[model samples]
Target: LEPLAEAGVDAVVLGCTHYPLLRPVIETVGARMFPSGLTLADGAEATAAELATLLTERELRGAGPGGLEMLVTDLPDRFAEVASRFLGEDVEGLAVKQVDL
Candidate 1:
């Protein structure tokens, strides 16, 4: 926040999945630190919207229940917990796999 404020950033693009969870705090801090207003862009939301559009345009939208597969290089349990919080549901039963990068 301090670095961004010092750099006089006009906008901030949240590129990480976990960053959105801290949006409120980041915005508040940024507002206090920045001389001008700071615009925040959620990459996840944008990505999801674009994916939806592509699926629709390509006629690839699924008709039945959708599924989620989580692949991580490390910490599957922790990832599941955090993902559950973001998804607003339990991810304990979801398909999760850890792979070497």
Candidate 2:
């Protein structure tokens, strides 16, 4: 953070997908928000458009989303109950691993 201030990057992008969830804290620390405000499939479309331009410039474009593979690192006790509501399907017959951490 200090280096960015010294080096003068006027705008910073928190590129992590989940960083948007910390918008409140980021603002409290004096950062700006420029959100596309789209999720999931919509996010994929926006991503594709933005990436297509860059890939065309450098010719690095290739197909994406070979398939979906979800692996969660810490399955909370209530994960089953809450996941179905968010994922829109019952998460039965799926095994979640437990770790001490």
Candidate 3:
């Protein structure tokens, strides 16, 4: 936060899927750290919108059930717990696997 403020950053983008969860904390810190007005962009929302547009343009929208597969480099249980928060549902029975790079 300090470095970004020092660098005169005007905006911060939440690029990762989990990053939106930290938006409030990040905004609070930015408010304290940044002298000028800072704009926070939600990349998750932008990505979702773009994906929907692309699907519609490509005529690839699906009408069937959707499946999600998660792969983690480490800590599958912790990832599942955190992912459940983002997904707004329990991921207990979801297929999550830990893989080596």
Candidate 4:
């Protein structure tokens, strides 16, 4: 990060789905390293938009609020708690489908 900052990188792509969770930490570190503000581009939103465009182009998009299906290799006790953070919604009633991997 320091090297990139020194190189004067103007923007950084939050490439991973998990990267947004660390945004606060990343912003703090970036503020210290980069005297000028650095732009954080969310790859997740871009990916979702691209997926939607492709689906629409192929006329494969469904109408109505689609149900969520989560497949996990193993279901943890705190799964709902953690998943809620990602989805930004209460998922207490959501069923967890565990699959054998």
- Could you give the candidate ranking by lDDT, starting with the highest? 1, 3, 4, 2
Q: For candidate 3, lDDT tens digit of each residue in 1-101? A: 78888899999888876688988889898888986778999978988999999999999999899898899987999998888887799996899999999
lDDT of 4: 0.84
Q: Cα deviation of 54 in candidate 3 (Å)?
A: 1.3
Give the per-residue Cα lDDT of candidate 2 at 67. 42
Per-residue CA lDDT of candidate 1, range 1-101, in tens?
A: 88888887889999987799999999888878876799999999989999999999999999999887889887899888988888899997888999998
The TM-score between candidate 2 and the true structure equals 0.33
Off by over 4 Å in 3: 85-88
CA shift at 69, candidate 4, in angstroms? 1.2
lDDT of 2 by residue, 1-101 (tens): 44655555445565655455554565555443223221222354478799889988998866666543335555644655566665678764466545563
What is the lDDT of every predicted structure here? 0.89, 0.54, 0.88, 0.84
Clashing pairs in 2: none
Report the poorest 10 consecutive residues by lDDT, candidate 2: 33-42
Quality of model 3 by C-alpha lDDT: 0.88
Which residue runs of candidate 1 sit more than 4 Å off their true CA positions? 85-88
- For candidate 4, write residues 22-60 as lDDT tens digits: 888989999998888989999898889999999999999
Local lDDT at 88 for model 3: 90
List the candidate 4 regions with Cα displacement exceeding 4 Å. 1-11, 73-75, 85-88, 98-101
Better of 1 and 2 by lDDT: 1
- The worst-scoring run of ten residues by lDDT in candidate 3 lies at 13-22
**TM-score against truth, every candidate:** 0.84, 0.33, 0.77, 0.66
Query: Better model by lDDT, 2 or 4?
Result: 4
lDDT of 2 at 27: 54
